[model samples]
Target chain A: MDLLLILFETGFWAATVRMATPLLFGTLGELICERAGVLNLGIEGIMAAGCMAGWTWVYFGGDLWTGVLFAAFVGACFGLLHAIFTVHLGLSQHVTGLGITMLGAALSSFVFRMLLPNITTPPKIIPFAPVKIPVLSDIPVVGEILFRQSPMTMLALVAVVAVAYVLKKTPAGLALCMTGENPSAVESQGLSVFAIRTTAVVIGSAFMAVGGAFLTLSAFDAFYIGMVNGRGWICIALVVFASWNPGKALVGTLIFAAFDALQMRVQQQTAVALPYQFYLMMPYIFSIVALIVMSRRSAYPKALLVPFRKGER
Target chain B: MRLEPRAHTSMAMTILVPVGAAALALMSCSVLILWAGASPFLALTLLVKGSLGSVFALSETLTRTIPLIFTGLAAAVAFRAKLWNIGAEGQFYLGACAATWLGTGAIDLPPPLLIPLLFAAGAIAGGLWLLGPTLLKTRLAVDEVVTTLLLNFVVLLFVNWLVFGPWKDPMAMGWPQAEPVVDAALLPPLVAKTRLHGGLLIAVFAAVLFWVVMKYTTWGYEIRAVGNNQAGATFAGIPIDRVVIRTALLSGGIAGCAGVSELLGVKGYLTLDLSPGFGYSGIVVAMLAGLHPLGVLLSALFIAALSIGADSMSRALNISNYIADIATAISLLAVLAGMMLTRYRIRFR
Candidate 1:
C-alpha cells in the first residue's frame, strides 16, 4: 500500500507533466499539418534539426529563447520544403517526408561533429528551471504538481487552449479542416487550399521545432545522436490515437508520458526480475494497442495524403 | 508554368530523370562540403577513388551492397503490389535472432544442412514478424503504414531485451552480444584478403529471381495490375487480399534473408546496431530504382558506393561522414522532383 502511494506521489505527476511537454508540442504540430491535408513525415528530421540548432545556439552564448526561435525557423524551412514537394510539385508524401528526415538527421550530426570535435565529455548548457507561481504553488498537491512547472510546460498548456480555440471557432481553421476533408468543397468556397495548407505546414513545423528545442533546452542540456529517438514518430501515432482532435492529443500525450514516468520509477524502485527495457517499451506498446483499437474507425481527414491539382476531379 | 500529364512518357526521359537528379544533388551537396571547409572537387574525387578506385575498395563496396540488395528487393516486391512494408528493419532483427538461435545450438549438423536451415530460419522469422501487420492490413483494413512503422520500434526493443538479458554473452565482460555461432554457420569468404563472402551470391541470385518473377510470372502481372489500379484488378477477378498477404510474406522473407546474411556472412553474432538503417535505406534504393527489381541492383550498388565512399571522403577531407547521407537524401529529393518531368511537361501559362 505504501509502495502504491509512493507511485502516486507528487513527484511522479510532476515527472509525467514534464515528460508530456514535448509530445504536447509535437502532437499539436502534427495535428495542424494533418488537418490541412499534408502528412509531414519529416517530423523526425525536423525535430533533430531543431534539437541541434537549439543546442548549438544556446551552447554558443545565444539567449535560450533565441535558440528556441532559431530552431523554429529551421523547422519552418523544412516545412516549406515539404510544402513545395507535396503541395506544389505533387510528389509522394512518404518519399518526400522520409527524404527530409534523412537529410535533417545527417545535417545535424555532421554539424554537431564539426562544432564539438573530440570532446571527452558531452557538452551541456544550463537547462530551463522550474518557476513557482506565487500563492498558487503554496496550495498543497495541486500546486506542487501543476503550479510549479517550467515555462515551456506552461506554454504547452496555453498552446492546447489556443489550438482548440483556433480549430473550433475560427474561419481559417474551418478552411484548413475543409481542405483536408475535401479540397473540392474548399475550392468551391472560394478559398485557396494551397495557401491554407502551406500556412499550416509552416506553423505546424514551428511547433514541432519548439518541441525539439524543449527536449534539448528543458528535458536536458546536451544534444546527442538519436536524441529525438522516434518521439516524432510517437506523435504521428498519437495524432491517429487522438482522432485529429487537439484536446484529445493533449490527453493522449499525458497518458503516454505517465506510462513513461511510471516505468522509469518502477524500474528504479522495484526489486522485480523483469528486464528494464520492457519499461521503456511501455509507451510504444500502448500506442500500438491504441492504434489497433481505434485506427479502423478513426476519423482521418479524407484527402490526407492526396495531392490537390487545380481543376482536377 | 503549369504541369500537364504526358500521353506517353519517352524511354529516354525515364533514364534521363534520375541521372539529372543525381547531378543536381551533387551540385547542392557541394555547398554543404564548402560549409565543412573542404573543396567539393577534392571531396568528390576522393569519394570516387575511395569507393571504387582500388580492388579492395570495390570489394568493400560490394560487401555493403550485399545486404542492400536483399532489402531493396524486399521493398521492390511489396511496392509492386502497392503494399508498404515499413517493418523491414524489425523483420531483419527478428530474422537475425532466429539465425542466432539456430546457429549457436548444440547440434553438430553438417555445413550444407546447417547453412540452409539457418537461412530458412531467418526467412521464416522475418515473415512471422510481419504477420501481425499483414493480417491487420488485409483483414481489418487498418493502415499498414502506422502499424508497420511502430512494429520496428517494438521488435528493436525486443532484440535489445534479448541481447541485454537472455542472450548476453558471459565471456564478453559487459558488451551486449549473443554467443558466437558455430564455425560451420559462418559464410565462406568469396575473396582472399577481403571481407566479401558467399552471401553476395545469394543477394545477386535473389535480385535476379525477383526480376524474372516480376517480369515473366502471371502472379507478377496480377500484382502489377493491383498496384496500378486495385479496383480494376478486383473487377478483373484478381484475389486482392491473397495478393496482399502473399506479397507481405515474400517481402518480409527477403528482408529476413538480408539480416541473416549480415549475421552469418559478416558479424557472426547477434549485436545491437547491426543494420545501421539498412531497412530505411532500402526504401531509398527502391525509390531510386523506380521500384523495378532489375533497377534495384544498380541503385543498391550506387547507394552502397556512396556510403563507402563517404567514409574515405570524410577521412581525406577531415569532414564528417554524414555528408554522404546528405548527398544521398538530396539525390532522392532531386529524383522525386525530376521524376515529375518524365511524366508531365511544364508549359508557360
Candidate 2:
C-alpha cells in the first residue's frame, strides 16, 4: 500500500510538473510560430543556445532574470537569421530551420567551452522559489499544482493567455494569421507579409528561448551538454497535438509532462520486471502514437511549411 | 516587369564554383581556428596529417567513414525518391537495438551464421521503424519530414530506456550500457592493429550496388521519374505510392546498417550515445554529394577524415575539436550554395 501510494502521489504528480514545465514553454513558442505560418524547426537548437546563454549569464552575474532576457535576445537574433534565409533569401523554410538548428548547437558548445574552461564542477544557480498565491494556496490539489510553481511557470501561464488573446482578438494577430493561411491574400490587402512573419518569428523564438532559460535558471540551475534534451522537438509534437491552439497546447504539454513524470515515478518503485528502458521510451512512443492519431483528424494551416513569394498565388 | 535571360556560365566556371566555394569555406574555417588562438595554417596541416599522415590515421578515418557511408546512402536513396527520411538517426538506433537483441538473445550460431543474421535483423528493424512514417505520407498525405524527425526523438528515448533500464549490464557497475556481444557476433578486423573492420567493405558494396540499381534498374528509373514529377510519373503509369514506400523502407534499411557497423565494429556494445548525429551528418553528406550514391561514398570519406582529423588537431595543436565541426558546416553551406550556381546566375540589379 505504501509502495502504491508513493507511486501515485510523489512520483506521478511531482514528475508531471517537472516534465511539463519545459514542454509547456516550448510548445507555446511553437504554437505561436506555426500559427504565424512559419515552421521553426530550429527550436531544438534555439533552446540549447538559451540553456547555455542563460546558464552562463546567471553563473557569472547571479541574476536569473538577466539570464532569461539574454536568452530571449539570443533567440531573437537567431530568429532574425532564420528570417533572412527564409523570407529575404528565398531559401526553403525546412532547410533554413535545419541550418539554424545546427548553427545554434555548434554555437552553444563553442561558447560553453570558451566561457567555462577547465571547470571541474559545473556551476549552479539558486533556482526560483515556488510562489503560493494568497487565496489560491487554500484550494485543493489543483491549486497546489497550479499556483505553487516558480515564477517561470507563472510567466508561462501569463504568456499563454496573452498569446491566445493576441492570436484571436488583436488585429496584428489576424494579420499574422492571414499571412500564414494565405500570404497572397494578406499581401493583397497592402500589408507586408515579411514584416508580419519576421515579427512572429522573433516573438516565437523569444518564447522558446525563455523555455530553455527556464530549464537552466529555474528547473535544474546548471546547464549540461544537450541540455534541452529533445524538449524542443517535444514542443513541436505538442503544437501538432494541440492543433496549433495555445490553450490546447497547454493541455497537450501537460499530458506529455504527466507521461514523463509517470515514467520517472514508475522506475522508482515498480519491479515491473521489464527493462526500465521500456518505461523511459514511454513518452516518446506516446507522442508518436498521439501524432499518428491526431494527424488522422487534425487540420493544419494551409500554407504551414510553404514560403511565400510576392505575386505567387 | 520583364527580365532578360542571363547567359549560362561556361563548364569551366561551373567547375570553378565549387572550388571557389571550397576556398571561401577554408577562409571562413580559418576564422574559427583564429578564434581558438591557433594558427590557421598549423591547424589545417595538423588536420590533414592526422587524417591521412599514417596508416593508422587512414584506418581510423575509414572506421569513422563506414557508418557515414551507410547513412549518406540512406539519405541519398530517400531524397532521390523525393521522400525525405529525416529519421535516419532513429532508424539507426532501432537497427542497433534489433541487432543487439538478435546477437545477444536470439542467435547462438557460429560466426558466419551470426554475423549475417545480426546484419539482417538490423536492416529489418530499420525498415519496419520507417514503415509508419511512410504509411502516413502515402495514405494520410502527412508530411514525412516532420513525422520522420519526430520519430527520431521517440527512438532515442527508446534506446535510452533500453540501455538504462533492462539492458544494463548485470555484472558491471551503474554505467548505462549493454554487455559487449560475443566474439562470434563481432565484425572481423580489416587491418592488423587498427580499429578498421569488415563494415567498410559492406558500406562499399552497398554503395556500389545502389549505384548500379539507380543506373540500370527499371524500379530505379521509376523512382527518379516520380521524384522528378509525381503527377507526371503517375500519369505515365508508375506505381508512385508504392515507389515512395519502398524507397523510404530501403533508405531506412540501409541506414540501419550504420547501427550494425557501430555495434559490431566500433563500440562492440550498445550505449545511449552510440550515434553522434550520424543521421543528421548524413544530410550534409547527401547534400554535398548531390544525392549521388558514389558521390555519397566520397563525401562520407571526406567527412570522416574531417571528424578523425579534428580529434588529432585538438590533441596536436590544442585547437578546440569543434573547429572541425565548424569546417564541415562551412563546407556543407558552401557546397549547397555552390549547387545553386548550377541552376541560377546571381546578378546585381
Candidate 3:
C-alpha cells in the first residue's frame, strides 16, 4: 500500500512500459528531429492527430496496424507542413512548431466532431490486444515487465533499437548529425540538408504519431480531447535528459514511466493524504527536475533550432 | 526552390502577403465547412455576423479579446527578446489563483484601490512563476520552451488540486470553483448585460504602453538588440542574461495580468476553465501581429472574432468550433511564410 510496495509490483512495471511506449515514441521522435537540427514542436498536435487518425481508421473498419500506419501518414503530412515552413522556408522554428501543434490538434478535433457531432459519449473501438513475445515473456519477472504488452509496445521497443542502430551506425544518420552540427559542412559534402532535416522531421513526427496511436489503439479504447495532455512536452524535456541519444532516451522514458505509473498506484493508496491532482502533477514536476539536472551537461545539437539556407552560409 | 534575400521589401508585398495568406488559410479550411454540410460562404457569414453584426455580439467578442490581448502582449514581449514563454496559459492560471486567494474574502478595499492591488498581485505571481524557467535558461543553458511548457501542466494540476480541495467553494452547490471575489474587487461593467467590462480599457492601455516602451525605451532597445543578434549585443556591452530575465518578468507579468483581468472583470471567480487556452491562443495573436505590441491588440480582436464567429457557425451548422482554432493556426503558419516572402524571394530552379 506504500509507495515502495507499489514499485515492486509486476503490474506497475508493465503499466510503466505501456506508458513509456508513448513517451518512448515521442522522446525518440523528438530525439530524431533534434539530432537532425530541427525542433519539432509539433509533437503534441501530431500525437493528437495520430490518436484521432488511428481511432477513426479503426472505427471505420480497418486493421490496427494499418490504422497506426494511417496515423503515421497523418503525422507525416503535418511534419511535411512543418518542414515546408521551418526546414525549407527557414522560418522561426519556435513559432512554426507551435503553429503546427495548434493546426494538428485543432484539425483533428474538428474532424472528430464533424464525424460524430451527436454522440454524447465518445465512441470506443476494439484496440490492439496484448501479445506476449513467445520466449522472452516466459522468463522471470523481467520478462513479464518487458515482453507481455500490446503489439504497439513491442513496436516501440523495436523503434528504439532501430533508431539507435541507424543513428549510431548508418550513413544517413551521419549526414543528419552533420546537418545538425554544421549544415555548411553538410552542404559542402554534396548532400541536401533540407532533404535530410525534412526526412528526420517527417520520420520523427511519424514516430510521435505512432506514440499517440499507441494510446487510443492500445492503451485506451477511445480518443478524448486533451488525452495526449502534456506527454509530448514531457518527451521534449526527456530529449534533453537523454542528451538526444536514442539508447539513453529508452532509459529516460522508463524512469519517467516508472515514476508516472507509480504515481497512479500511489494515488490509489487510502493512506496517502495528498490530493490526486498532485499525483497527476508528478510527471511534469519530474520533467522540470530532469531538465534542471541535465541542463548543464545536455549537449543539444549545435544547429538544432538554427535555420539552413542553401549557399548563404 | 531556393531563397534569396530581397534588397528592399516593397510596401505592396508587405500588405498583400498577409491578406493573401489569410485568404489562402480560410480557403483551405472551407473543405471542412463543406464536409460539415454547410456552405463555406454561409459559414463565413455566420462567423462575421456572430462576432460583429450587433452591439451585443461585438461586446461579447470584446470580452473574449481582453485576455487574448494580455496574453498576446506577454508572448510578443518575450518572443521579441528571444525568450519562448509558452507557459502563459499556466501563468494566466497562477495569476487567477493569486487573485482569487486574495480577493475571496481575504482582503476588502475600495474599488479604486482593490483592483490595482489585485492586478499587482497577479502580475507578481505570474512573474515569479516564470522566474524559475528564465533563470534556468540564463544560468544553466536550459531550453525555456520545454521547461515553461511542462510548468503549464503543473500549474493547471495545482489549480485542479486547489479547486477540488482547499479552495473549493462550499457555498457553490457542488461546483469545483473558488469563492467569488468581493464585489469591490470586480471590474465595473462597461455594459449592462454583456460580459464586457473595464478590462477592455486596461488591456488597451497595456497594449499602447507596451508599444511605446518597446519602440522607445532603452530597455526595449536592449530587448530587441539581444533578440536580433545575441553575439553582437554581447559585443556591444548589453547584459544579455539580465535583459532576458527582465523580459521574462515583464512578459510573464503581462500574461499574469490576463488572469487577474479575467478573474476580476469577467468570471469573478477562479475555475479550471477560466482562460480556456488563452495562453496558447496568445501565441497565435502575437504571431498574427508579427510580434508587434500594438499589433497584438488588433490581432487579439481578430482572433476573438474568429472564435466568436466560429462558435455561432458551429452551433448553426452542427460543425465544430475547433474550426476557428484551425483558422488561426493556418493563418499563423501562412503569415510566417508570407512574412518570409517579403524578406526573401523563392525561385524554383
Alpha-carbon RMSD, each predicted model: 1.5, 3.3, 1.3
In TM-score terms, candidate 3 sits at 0.98
- Docking level for model 1: medium
Stronger candidate by lDDT (1 vs 2)? 1
- Give the TM-score of chain A, superposed on the true chain A, for all candidates in the order listed: 0.97, 0.94, 0.98
User: Which candidate should be chosen as best, given TM-score against the real structure?
Assistant: 3
lDDT of 1 by residue, B62-138 (tens): 99998889898888888888888878899999889999998997657988889888989999999887778888888
Candidates' interface RMSDs, in order?
1.4, 2.5, 0.8
Alpha-carbon lDDT, every model: 0.88, 0.81, 0.91
Candidate 3 segments exceeding 4 Å error = none
Q: Who is ahead in DockQ, 1 or 3?
A: 3
User: What's the iRMSD of model 2?
Assistant: 2.5
lDDT of 3 by residue, A63-128 (tens): 999999999999999899889889989998998989999999998898888888778899999998
Q: Per-residue alpha-carbon lDDT of model 1 for A1-313, expressed as tens digits?
A: 5457766699988898999998999999999999999998899899999999998999999988899999999999999999999988889888898898898899899899988877767789998899999999999998998889988898998999999899889998888999999998898888988888999999999999899999999999999988998888889989998999999998999988988887787788778747877777777778778777878879889999999988876
Sorted on DockQ, best first, the list reads 3, 1, 2
Clashing pairs in 2: A275-B166, A276-B166, A277-B161, A277-B162
- How much is B122 displaced in model 2, in angstroms? 2.0
Candidate 2 lDDT tens digits, A81-148: 77766665455566667667777887788777767766777777887888888888667776677777
DockQ score for model 3, please?
0.91
Residue B316's lDDT within candidate 1 is 81
